[model samples]
Target: MLMIRPSFDTLYEALLTRDPSYEGRAFVCVSSTGIFCRLTCPARKPKPENCTFHETVAECMAAGFRPCKRCRPTMPEASADPVVKPLVEALEKRPGHRWGEPDLVRMGLDPSTVRRAFKRHFGMTFLEMARQRRLQEGFSALADGGKVIDAQITAGFESPSAFREAFAKILGQAPGAFSSKPLLFADWVATPLGPMIAVTDRTQLHLLEFLDRKAFPAEFRKLQTYARGEIGFGRTDVSDQIQAELDRFFSGTGASFETKIALHGTAFTRDVWRELIGIPAGEIRSYSEIARSLGRPQAVRAVARANGANQIALVIPCHRVIGADGSLTGYGGGLWRKQRLIELEQGYRAKG
Candidate 1:
């Protein structure tokens, strides 16, 4: 069943009365307090002008409102489901543990049922989420300047070689390959959708990609060759600047990126990226449309390739590009993330 969002008056009345009928169906984002709450929240209500209603926690977050502590509006709606609650709690408690069907079976739960429950509530199976967490742990360890053995143990890898293989497969280089003394630095920045790896020098942001992107390894190698500097796990003032900008972006407070970025691409590709940056938030353009805007109407294919060639993610706004037929084309960060980003920017458009 499609759950439509309640009208503003309907939601305000519910909030004033602490109505339970709209418990999970509606949420309130308060501009004055910078927080979101459930209609049933026991805390004091804000003035009507300060309140904006949304249908989901994601929408509230996209508007830059943090969850209300008094009501815990960020809690999953399915947390009370018998099959989901315990498993979620277990995952939280054992984040680094490798979870599998056998583990669910040992817990006297049907693995298939568990998978379905998690996918319905979280948009991913429990095992997939668990693996992502494990990868985060390993990445965090390395970001902290820990050794390969330290990261392996922290990530729950069975052996050094196992950890290195997995790291190389994802990052395109083994942890050991990074130099202790280096000219360029890399760091991890956590985002609402996932973790992103940020590469920067002292002055300009060099690259930023979601850690899971399949092309990241090759992208990293290419950047290393171009910079003629060893890359290491460290942060620069530029990294700090981009992290702050990203925090504001996901919080829905602001979308403008002021971080200086080093654009490493051919002249044509650079022109395409500059055009992409011209795309306004909450708007989309087709590859052919981008080409035409650049006064190269016959270069539609080239526009698409240049879009794909963009190494910087949100800063470049490459996700704003679509197929000529208005279909979402491939994004290196995965189409799912691309969709979420587009949705998130709609909040920006609304506010503007």
Candidate 2:
């Protein structure tokens, strides 16, 4: 799965509007201009048909696109300017500091000015920027076997209630929802497609899905129940392995996954997923074909249902399953991604 990309038209529109959300996540390679630029690049916007979007700068370079001088696509992404640098450095140096406007004032910065500047540049307030940074750091600490007290302190939250409230405010879930010693942990994996949310234990990857799915919240709750509520914020050995394999897969250099996966679905669903994986990279299988292969020719609908129920996206290879008529069918991550994956696989296969 890549960044949660929209249709080409939508991306073109975002490029026209200079949507900052896509700054580094998506790149537009302009054939006419002979260069690729950030979506927010100030150069004269190119025509829509001349635009080709790639998930990473590496792709743009591979396709012979030089970075735009206006947007500086290859540069580090810290709100696109040096203004946020000092504030960010301050937060990192003192993650446990109680950040407030008065503190900014004492630091010789105007409160309203800083807030407006950050809001315009990063789509977040100055304090919000700090909170988010601290939250990620705190989650990292908690994932590394640190105590909750230590996690909060490391996150710069002076009180447990403050930390819990901040966590709940960002995640929209209770911070106390996990077991004392979690058997499962959830962390993020950055991909060319976007970011994938991964649920894993110390040994096996359980669930992996795109972050923007409409059914993600419910899917996470269901995973929590399947893991007997032993979910927390953290990274595991399996997640590290999964990310590495996925990186290779997306780079088109490897088509196999060596990491173990824990399937929490029904027996039929697991069977369907295993069959999906066996279909091979750069190939497609119809639902009926899969049902027949499973020795249950009448279970075509069941096969499709199981395909839909697959939580692990690229690893399970649900996108490999297509309509009986050879049309793209429903994909939890969207059909555009399915089409992209098929094209990618077919292209690699053709080259091989």
Candidate 3:
């Protein structure tokens, strides 16, 4: 992936020029509207301080901004073109499929047209998306203790070499190169709202994060590196324990988590996360208060960053963090979720 740095001057210039070239490459996040827009948006431009640029829709979404209605920043005009919809739907249906040019031809579609359609819609070709999906599934399976061959088959790779190449391409390592130890393992846990990934070692749980979280991949990579190729599938005793606890949590039987956690962070970060665990089910704390509790009243920003870096969702209690003004702040899982989580916890507390 190419890292495109946001240039305010250049992006503003594009906005001013209404340059079609910048339509898919750049987006403007508006502070006033709490939304982001493509450079080609017809709305009057906002001040520089009120504008932030992003390279991808995922980045904009991760930052807690909505797509502008006027601009329709998220779905470019090309995406809505009739030729693309079928290919997009097919890709979505079997994301794990090993798609090639022949596969497209077999499907009675022109490969180049499909590629162009995907590029226009998602900023990547259908092949690339399929490859990424396969890798993601394989990674999840491996983390859940699936055998190497099983992971390969699950990913729809006909050969081990192809599977390994795809895995290394996305995750920077081959499947077998990852940890085979019984240490900490992670897997996707489907929920009503969305899928969440959970990680656990033999004696304690480690991470639980929503699948859609942009920070999730980076955090999982960090954990994989920390495990030094020792991570593998199959649940640890601790993982099973946490799974049961999570079951209770969702079933409304309880909102309590007693799973041991293997926290990975600096002393200060750990302190902030520990405080999050202490927040009552129905209660919340401002970032400023959390910083003060850590004896660093001025470290509110640092506290917020640590909170953002937290991988263990719900369990570590990072969702309890709010803005200083008692407003909902940044949540990796999305603000709608944060509000719902707070409400759920409040209901749980009330019942208790």
In terms of TM-score, the best-performing candidate is 1
RMSD list, candidates in order: 6.3, 10.8, 14.9
Question: Compared to the true structure, candidate 3 yields what TM-score?
Answer: 0.59
Compared with the true structure, what per-residue lDDT tens digits does model 3 show for residues 119-225? Answer: 75656676766665565566556765678898898788889998888666544457686566546675545443344667777677778888777777688778888
The worst-scoring run of ten residues by lDDT in candidate 3 lies at: 186-195
**Candidate 2 lDDT tens digits, 1-352:** 1546676777788999989877667888765444678889888887654567786655554444445667766554554555565776676467557689889888788888888876664455768656544654676666566778887888887788988887654344556765667888887665556556788888888889886666777788887777777788777778777876765576566788888888888899999999998988888999999999999999999999999989888999999988988899899888888888898788557866
Instruction: Give candidate 2's TM-score.
Output: 0.61
Runs of candidate 2 with Cα error greater than 4 angstroms are: 1-141, 144-172
lDDT of 3 at 346: 84
Candidate 1 lDDT tens digits, 1-352: 1166555677789999998888777888765455679899999888775666767655554334555667866455877888877776786566667788999999889998988987676455778767766776677678778888888887878887888898889778889988788788988765656557889988999899887788888999999898674888887888777876776676566799999989999999999999999998899999989999999999999999999989999999999898878889899999999999999899999998
Where is model 3 more than 4 Å wrong at Cα? 1-146, 158-173
Q: lDDT of candidate 1 vs native?
A: 0.80
Q: Could you tell me the TM-score of candidate 1?
A: 0.72
Q: What's the residue-level lDDT of 234 in candidate 3?
A: 57
Task: Give the best candidate by lDDT.
Answer: 1
lDDT of 2 at 289: 98
